[model samples]
Target: MQTNSSAKKSKHILGLVIVDGVGYRNFLLSDFVNQSLNTFDEVVIFSGLPSESFEMQERANVSIVELPVFQESGKTWFWRKAKEVAHMQLHKYNFAGIDYNLQKNYPITKTKRALITKMIFRITSVFHSEKWINRFYRNQVSSFKKDEVTKVYSELLKREELDLLFFTHQRPPYLAPLDYAAKKLGIKTCSFLFSWDNLPSKGRMAAPFDSFLVWSDLMKKELHFFYPETKKQPVEVVGTPQFEPYVLDRYTSSKEDFYHKFELDPDLKTICYSCGDASTSKNDPFYIEVIAKLMEQNKLIEKVNFLVRTSPAEDGSRFKEVNKRFSFIKWNYPKWELTRKDHPEPWSQRVPLPEDLKDLRSFLKYCNLNINMCSTMSLDFMLFDKPVINPTFGTGENDLYDDQKYLRYSHYERVLESGAVAIVKNEEELVREINFSLKNPEARLKEQKELLELQIGKPLKGTSQRIAENLNEFSKA
Candidate 1:
């Protein structure tokens, strides 16, 4: 780590980069921006969102800059895809999720792109060393820096005179030029690992940084295991601000208010079913039907109010038929807007509304039990000491995408071992587990605490402050 002695004596400027809705929610919507402003002289946010849609409470010593659109050449695209395939080939044997994604994405197809990608995979598989992976990564980064976007970002950074560049998410391909520009201008850079499963299942990051911010020591170990090159860089475990809203008073609503707003019976216990995106959990409607039918038949131990919160990454139109059939199931569509309609990826363009934070917090606070395939909502509900039920009822061999395989992934193995949540494989097990959980919500309280501690190293109350302090310390190192 290089120490900036001048930064300690003079004003320090922090450049915060947010590329998507999740990042916007985690950093700008949280206390991270306020904490950073308190630590640094000025805080500039380089955002991928449109200026009109960048909704945040204005503050002094804070500004927002719209990032330029990155245009990728054919060579850069080829190198990027090749690097992803090569990385999966290198570690597919160790990570089941990576193996599944590799097999599912690049199968024996007849398309020209698939054929070319497979050929790249084969050639890279021969030289399956970390050295070769680094070579591929360098090729992609070098190719990306040649674009005009790099010059635009370089000029912006120069004008801002940034002491440190911080990235909220590390995997967006569009961020390569910004990262490269920061490094080119001799500015310190840092990135936060996006999610627990990102290191093992996702491919290589867009670029390397001087420091890394992770959620736990477990994630730090995983980073070293996957990318040994990061051993020399500082990896700080500051925890994530995603669950901080659960403890914040502003994001909470009274149970009566929540029930009345959602138009649900206050007498019945609430069971929330959080849906995955369209590609990850295509059979969510089937699962919804199973629970609704059980509720209709009076098969459960008690009558309960059912709520479904669809993924913010996708619209809820896919569940229109199911919603119509199960009129009893209350729907809580996430309040996320598509700010950038022309963006290549629709998921990246969706930004959550600030009001959704209160709604989500209320849902987590009041829900008696949460049901999903394999999601981080398990952690969120567990944060509130609520029971969670994960249903894996389909076979990968027969189904288009296997929800069961998620149970065997490297990141999820700890959840299974901790026994913090019930894993129900079939409808009978799901019914039995739901009944058991309702009867004994605190049965796995100890395990949930252990799992939460193991996954989230730092306390959740001051996560944003901790992260900001670490960034300031790293800047002055």
Candidate 2:
């Protein structure tokens, strides 16, 4: 509750965060913003959309600025378009830097065009050193993009002198231009290692950052491995703020109330099946059906009830047919309401009005066994010391789905290495794993404990505090 008079004495710090999706809610729920309020005299947040969870307008010291997502223009737009052509050409040479999903999903005509363009680049690369050309092209494109970014946002940035420029996520296109603006004004910049898979699996970052804050030592290692150039810069391990609420009692619900809300039989063993997004795990409905069939046949453990929690990005309408077939299974759909159905791609501006933390806490608390197809929820369940089952089975002809291949992705590699979960490959394995988890709930107790420690690190408390302190210390320097 900062006052006008008191706010006048505070230093101004600019903060950038994307409240576009539920995945980013941790930045709002955690101590990052709260600590900014305490440490800085005045704080300005440039966000895609306002968050209901964080009522910044009510605070006297905080202000919200609606910034546009990035678009290429001026000299940069020309170079950007050219680079796209060159990149397509380089791909034909099997240079190995292209985004595979993009190529895989492209229309047949587009793929052919890309292939022809790649052949052209391959021929040119042979005569003119492919590695050097690629490096030179990257550096040039990056430089022009930065220049154009500064040109576009210079006026907005000149409004005030900021003590620190902090961007919460690295993948957003808007960050590079914003970072360019910060550099033009000589403002110190910082960014968070936003996701678990960002380093290993995700494509190139928007831009190089002055300071990098990561979730764990594992993430620090990943930053070095992927972008060794950043090794010279400061890489701070602040842990992740998403799990901070779990350490607090205020967010947890009473066991009796939690059971009653979802209409569960307290005597029955409750199993949770968390679904992934539609694009990747299109067969989630099929998997849910399998569980329903097992339950109906009484093949599973006696009196074992199943609950399905759909992905936050989806409306859960895809499961309507399955739900009608299996009226016995319970569900908890995301409560987010979208204002504009056509807000734009990436839908980063989608507003999430949810009791998400409380609900997730309850889910992990009451569910005896949790199941999903390689979801981060496994980590959440592990934090609660609950067992998890990852069913790698697919639906449809030939059992094809991108999610089947996701099990082999680098992001899930560490979790798999930890061996805390039961990776079931087929229907029989899925049933066996579920029954085993129900019968021997503590089958992987030692493994689960070790996995939690390795992934999340110990002394889970004070993650937000540490982040705040680090920001404050940097501001002073």
Candidate 3:
């Protein structure tokens, strides 16, 4: 018992990861992990499936204990993992069963072929859609999977095992169970407010930790609204982790190559339309479709250039036809560990920075303006006090859960009203909004100043330190 207790006392800090979003989570999670390694005694990673995220994860830490199917010899652990998958799969496909029963109860199965086709499609979709695959992987290994892991750590504690623990998400699909179990076992635990889904509503912002670290108030407000039940926990709103790389890249940049690469006018304004993965993407008028059609019909306008951001999984499927007529920057999603291997020096610093990125910051930074469908980039542009255009496209006639409707941009409507954004409804309106933003630059700049006022005096740095500090407090509390 003394030895076990000594072991527990010896090293007890872990940065529990819920898998990095491919490379997206790299900078964000890495900052925490690297910093934790320096500050904490132990670091544990919780990740998704191997085929999807294994390579990227192990790059950070080889000790990653994957969720259910993500383990190295996953099949060997089937019995142990099966029940976990079963429970999680039930919750994910719960809606499917309910829908299926409703359909059959209505005798819709008289068309057996349709059912077969749908089943085939669902199966196909699981592999064909990276987004769907990601969702499946996340759900299957959910935050509860952490619960099982916590049990493992607790038993190991008897053998002198345990340490600090950190959680990655905020709600239903997350690995919160691991967090709860760890807290109960007296392990230090903390959660990174990685997305808008976990935000509390206006009233639910009870503090969930001795220190809750978040990117923006969007998270705080959302957490407050949904979990108002918890008394307000100590919270710190840090700037978006994604911005760290951008800022780092910016500090070392000449930002001039953009003009040479595009071979375009030196004086025109450029607006980057960053495409984010949102439920809205699949539904609406397919962004490129509307943009291309508008450009062809003569409304895309002059003096303003648009650059489309592409993801690793994006196969010109969304933009091939559009590219035939217009040009775009194949903006690679900036990855952390991979960046060193692939792009030794990021384009952000290369001599001629990408032109279409407005001049002020990233090409997405410009004196004229920047636009996005529902991307969080739009939020970043909001930082410049410039106009960001958001065009709303409904993903479904009826929202499965309105919150499920690309809740990534929670304060979206508020930002628009705050003069930080202009919400355009369709292609025609989008073209018009873009034209208006460029033609009236001064108006947009004024609004940019307005938004900056809100950012000032906010706790915007040292999220890692704050997180470490809070984890220490939570372990005691």
Candidate 4:
């Protein structure tokens, strides 16, 4: 593919890659697309989802291109897994989250492929230098280019005359070819660190971009700490677009309207129990039952309404029996749609609808208290100045993958130290914390603000505009 630099005089086109549902929510569903269009001559969204899934009418100077499903070859997969294992081994002692993941995933009586991966990782760990890590990353990158996807991206980048390529989520391995093509064509590339726990807990990044955009200065520091090579690259601390809707007027609804929509009682204080995915918090049903039973037995200090918001990444069918048992629990099932049923990673193909955004915003705004198993929703509630309680009770097995272990992860350390949230270990503490939080909603106000500042590193408003301004500046350079 030929470069379009000579054909175009001054037209600056930006290519934004959306790798997953969260990316769709953060970029396309937010004000980001409009903001980018305002700053650039044109914007092209290269989405991992099908174009039909968006249900959006294409506007002038903007196009949405659906990416072909990325098929990883066996060799590519092996190297990628090897790199991840080596990275986990390298940082296991530094971050407890990495250590936990390593201990859990390490091959014991697993498949032959797993055993070979472990063997290769052991050999790689013998060297374990930053140089070795970079080599492993480069090998993975090279292996990805062996496929036809690189050519596809090369053609797309050249055809669009894209001056800058930005990845909404940095961790998906499918992004490697696109990143490679951008680099080969000399287009500037930048990747957003997806979540708070991504850098420390998630394995090696799929590809190395020219720069990185992070949620906070703390995250920027984390990026440099985990990938020291990124230290020399530009790391912009623009607060994430994920929480922008919390402050947006259009996403908000009146208290009465919100209560009526969910059949919530306006007279009672609402305690929202936000559930993580099935894999992350399998004990969510048990937690919900405990809360329901507390309300059933009238053990609480005051009668408050219970609201359960299931994870958008999953269907909440698992809570059917619990919902049936607890009639009073107002359930807000997420409105995310499954776009590609045949996709290998079904979770990635799930796309969030715009209505869900409004529903989520309302839930955060009007809910008096929030409860979860150490989720980012805690930060969302904190942004609203609402009290939060993290229930960390497992099945008392004390084995690996216990829900209780999440509190000790590296990312949650700041949360624990902040004293902004109540961490309950058992039903007794859970009852006490929930009642106390409802009674004194402003008890942790100061700490919550401090923690938000530490996590977000920017004012809540205009985060999308900030990101756009940065992207425009990067495109021009």
Candidate 5:
């Protein structure tokens, strides 16, 4: 428990980190904690809530502090409205940074009218210019004034000389004040790009960072393409720490035990249907139905057994209607239990439990093919050299089924472009892809290789170690 003697050559190089919620603890922190502990002389975790997942070693070098979860406070709401006015002005200038691809892609009269409306925003925005807005906010509000929530961050820094401030997730507005305080104090700051879809789908970062850690070159490019201002910031490709276990040997589970646990037939080729989030893809049961229908018709049903693995954020209530009819289909709900309050919070819901780690490894190992509507599990399954099938078709319902919507998602553009997986349009194509993948498992090997190199990046093993090494080098510098 004694502190490392070599850690104190100068003022302690403390790495102050912000862990957003329960989900980050399991999915992110667990993978990177040991490395952080070893790389920094001292590590202090500023967390939104208290959880067993954040509990680290009893070593004297590590400390944990709980803080209120960042919510949209009055000050933030005012800032957001002010920024909206600024955004209106920028859009009038035909801002290249705005995510207008969706409008550009779908060219209809309505969109044209919308574009014209955005032009009108310029008139309203003229009264509240960007320069005026900045000056007003700066003169009226302080980043760490008594009424500001960021005052606590100033107090925390006053107690210790922090060398570095790192945020695991960069989009939380709550951290904006802290980042501002850090900048005023001249502390170096960095953040990890949370996910593949983050840059395109998510909002602007809470604050500009000194550096950023990305999963691959794809993400770094996304930062440049979307937020051109970030092009000058240092971006280190650390790969993704979540997939580290996929590359490790210790987390592997025996196939016999895994199949038995799931009550799956070991002889039959297993196909895992990883569900998407409820808000986006509530009709997951429809996909489940398509699989069930194919199984009933005995097309590839005899050869493949389909398993349903709901999203960690889903409670399986949406699947109840389909679940009752297709009682024969096997189900695998996420083992990570959530409280009533935790269920609604995305970050809290994403926190993986110990069992999830084992379950994921086993599912990937036993399943010969993976099926999902653009789940990150595709990357995980690819790591196991398994074929991935993305079902883009829908059941016969206008509101219920729309295949075109999934295609427009910006993140999947790269995956589809790379041809990493088979995109099945209907049941016929689904069966065809499944049979082909099972018959010729190595057919997509070339595509997977391309994805690994361009999309995921190489040296898949030891990502956590690489991240630690980079952090240590930064500290030394």
Candidate 6:
């Protein structure tokens, strides 16, 4: 555990910390860390909670630290009010039947339970937020995340003042303490593409980082389109390292091995979605019924693999808990375990995934055709010129808040417009499009070439290496 000589050259210690610390993050960090080559005297990782992978990082020239998990203080009336706010914020409409007045927009009726929840929320908001603020106290307010963060950074400075701190995502609760701490010590701070954070109340990525490294020109255009004023903020279209590994000529494992393990037919044209986040388990009205029904009924495509790799995102137990009802076997997604069993995955009410990058790439490579909603994994499919089928679910109001219309188009529009990717508006369309893409893949191949031109501006063989090159220039200073 010796520090690299490079660390001695500068008094400033580069402090790099991440926000979401579960899966592909380690691999993403590896692409950057490997490039650093132990350039920093130390690397500190900030996680909401520590996982097994966090404990095994002794050799990476870094230390993993967990931040306090924020939760509402107690079951006080005020706390309940905060919970109501969170619930309403998460759910589209009020539980109550308040839409009677706002029907132009709400348009729908509510259940008796919904009506009750709405009334409770109405009473809470009037009592807590309008008259007094303390009644709205929640985990965020109780934990004083900003203050706690300030204390953490203050102590880190006391131990060894940082010269530069790079934040993976910027939210006041997460970044405020570090921002204030770094500001106090005159440290430069920046953030990476953690995506639109709904916290901090100060606004979005266009503001936090001193500089940003965007994945594509499409993203850059959207940035300029949305916040047209702050157009001069420094940023780079450095591409994503997540895709760098996907651009290889030869994969480590044979695709046949993936099919045989799953009892999937090799002669069949496979189309699968890495199931971004299945929280409600059997929720998505389309997947549980439409997809399963189509796959089961379609004798023509029975030889074709129509699968969805459900990981542990929205609700970790999605694929494992409910999916076990279908005839399948045991094992995990990370282990490449394919089954249609009626029992639980070994994790006890949870589906498990591998916490490594190699395993993930292997998983992605196993499929001939890929489908997804909004996961960054789609970028990998685009990078390797794989056939893609994208579904624009049109998530109603939630889509409006994030300005999803403008943002998603950065990737979605370009791919769809170039005809490199197919956009299916609904489940029926998805069925038609998925089959069409497979049946006439050569046409897709031509579209894929055009898409390669739009998305991949530079003919990059190693995206990670290019990122490392950029960072090298920054570190040289």
- Highest lDDT, which number? 1
Tens-digit lDDT track of model 1 for 358-379: 9999998898999998899999
By lDDT, the better pick of 3 and 4 is 4
Taking the tens digit of each residue's C-alpha lDDT, what string does model 5 give over 1-477?
Answer: 445333343445555454543325333434566677667767666665454445533357767666555445455544543444443344433332233432332234566545544543444356455454554345323522444456677666545567777777776556667777777788888787877766665434666678888888888887777556677777788887766776566567888888888888778888888898786666678888988887887888356677889977767888888888987788988875453254225435344556677788888878888888766778878878899988877543655655445555566776889888998877789888888888888888888888877766647677777777676665555
Listed in order, each prediction's TM-score against the native is: 0.96, 0.85, 0.63, 0.96, 0.83, 0.66
Error of 3 at 274 (Å): 1.7
Mind giving the per-residue lDDT tens digits that candidate 6 earns over 409-444? 334445556766676666678788767766665557
Evaluated against the true structure, the overall lDDT of model 1 is: 0.87
Task: Please give the range of 10 consecutive residues that has the lowest summed lDDT in model 1.
Answer: 1-10
Model 6, residue 130: distance off in Å is: 26
Error of 4 at 467 (Å): 0.7
Error of 1 at 406 (Å): 0.8
RMSD of each: 3.2, 4.5, 10.0, 2.3, 5.5, 8.8
lDDT of each: 0.87, 0.69, 0.47, 0.86, 0.67, 0.48
> Which 10 successive residues of model 5 have the least lDDT summed?
96-105
Instruction: Tell me the lDDT of model 1 at 233.
Output: 90
Candidate 1 regions with alpha-carbon error over 4 angstroms: 1-10, 107-109, 398-401
RMSD of 3: 10.0
Q: lDDT at 84 for candidate 4?
A: 77
Clashing residue pairs for model 2: 10-41, 20-348, 89-118
For model 3, give the 10-residue run with minimal summed lDDT. 347-356
Q: How many steric overlaps does candidate 2 have? A: 3
